[model samples]
Target: MNGVIVGVRKDSQTYVNMKRKACAEVGIMSFDVDLPEDVPEADLITKVYQLNSDPDVHSILVQLPLPKHINEENALGAISIDKDVDGFHPLNIGKLAMKGREPLFLPCTPKKWHKDKGAKSSCSRSVRRSNIVGLPVSLLLLKADATVTTVHCHTKNPEAIIKEADIIIAAAGQACMIKGDWIKPGAAVIDERSQRPEQEIRIPIEASKVAGFITPVPDGVGPMIVAMLLRNTLDGAKWVIGQ
Candidate 1:
């Protein structure tokens, strides 16, 4: 979880080599699961259940959009919630919606995490932001310890949403969406612009250097997001064992 942990793949030799190198560096062992496209739904379910039952299998993930006949809902339901690190467990959803308790697997995205973890905290302050994308800025606001009351876009009152955040994460791609006066000034102004013009790159905020930890344009959050997904996979494995 700490270092760059990548999946070792059989598809491409390059990925396999990269994964092996990473494994060797960290003294991690690689497990090979037979990923046959031709595998039947029952067989796939059986294999997934096998992994769920295996103590050595820290996590079991039946990749999304599995073979058409696999009956995704049925297969997913068959997976033990404790092992459903992807958080597909019906029980997890139940807990999230009803109990307001932590799901067996929580989406690590900042905003999602905040909504769950920050539920108990009071919304003491507000910061308005226009985001290029909605979730990222909401995540930044959550990370900054600001509980977002509302999130809106150009179609709605962009300023109104910004006015709500104590720190405005101005991500709405509209150039110059937030005026200088719109912000609390010296309040966190996270402006995410382009770093890689060819690609839609996302830079994250460095909480230490910036006004108070902002998700910069194309750098910070994306990398962290990958790491979190990996973590969620590991946690999902743990959840299955609990069941």
Candidate 2:
């Protein structure tokens, strides 16, 4: 496993460290490239390409929030799809949302919530339609034979839509955006929003009283994504070794 971090923002630094710790726990060899905040775009992309070409490197993670001057797409696109453990490549995401096609890897965060069983014949509401979370989760639910309704900022009567579903997944990145009343009683809820100071603290407290199973913000969804990344790295290694 290798991490290429550019310019160190707090979130990027924290997550890279978390990945490193997880790598350590799982016995994956981890390497990092901490470039200056002002590193040239070409230089950064070259580093990613180098990692992609290295046979020994099974997984490649470039922490989010790259420096302002960097072209996020070009840098991320330089990574081989096979080594895109973060699953940010357009090809990977496209295949994930489409039917009858499999991606090299599922987006780590969303894959954990994309259940193969138990959600069948259920109606689920997914908040946000962003590529990373909402869209993929909805596709996964559809693959599981569940009816999925996606709600975004522009949706009307969002609460009414949410209350009708048997499952709710909130990934809007907004704090306390979905309240307890929005969740159907006895419904399973997965909250994916995380921000500093935890402005969304009330949802879990309130939802727990009504929800059949509620995932707490801090201990709930985030750790699963980390585990999936590690699992993806191991899977990537297996693919590389043809075992």
Candidate 3:
């Protein structure tokens, strides 16, 4: 199977490199398309279309946080649903939100880890409502018959809402945003925020003391996300091959 990654910016390059390594480990041919930070939105969408038509490329992923000038929705929408291994297309998300409907592929971040960790029946709270992770995950939890409360920036008494959850999925990009006091004792915490050396604590160390289970920033949800992406890519390839 073949996969193509389109990445912009330094951090995106770093992420793309990790994905390429994962693809290589699994014997999936990986292709890279690095566009300049200043590349026009039209050009980026054109690149996606090119990959979409390539029968050899079974999966196409565009690294997130494209340049400020680019429209993210337009770029994601350009990817063919068959090859949208990242599962960000509007149609995919639309299907995910409805009852008795399934998207071609579930977004990687919201797919596997929770089930593996046995959080399906837990009362869950998803922090922040961003399309990338939080919103989709909340939808998944609801589908699993888990009661879900979503806490966003506009949420009043956020701590009170959070304390009631049996499981928390924290993806608010702000470092140390969810304090120890905000978490319920013995609750499971999945910290999905990415970390940098300068900002090592996405969830404060104190929160770990209070929570029964919490994922460390660098080594935890990050690797699982990549694994699910590879899984989705492999599934797409199998579908193409009539498996």
lDDT of each: 0.46, 0.78, 0.86
> Per-prediction TM-score, please?
0.50, 0.91, 0.94
**For residues 17-121, what per-residue lDDT tens digits would candidate 1 score against the true structure?**
443354445544445454566666677677667766766655444444455555778767777666564455667655544433556665443333343333233
Q: Which order, best to worst by TM-score? A: 3, 2, 1
Candidate 1, 172: how far from true, in Å? 9.6
CA lDDT of 23 in candidate 1? 40
lDDT, candidate 1, equals 0.46
**Higher lDDT: candidate 2 or 3?**
3
Candidate scoring better on TM-score of 1 and 3: 3
Q: In order, how many clashes per candidate?
A: 37, 0, 0
User: Which candidate, 2 or 3, has the higher TM-score?
Assistant: 3
Tell me the deviation in Å of residue 221 in model 2: 1.2
lDDT of 3 at 183: 86
What tens-digit string does per-residue lDDT give for candidate 2 at 44-102? 88888888888878888877778788888988888899988878898988887688988
- Among all candidates shown, the one with the greatest lDDT: 3
The C-alpha stretches of model 3 lying farther than 4 A from their native spots are: 117-121, 194-200
Model 1 misplaced regions, further than 4 Å: 1-46, 62-78, 98-100, 111-155, 167-211, 216-218, 229-243
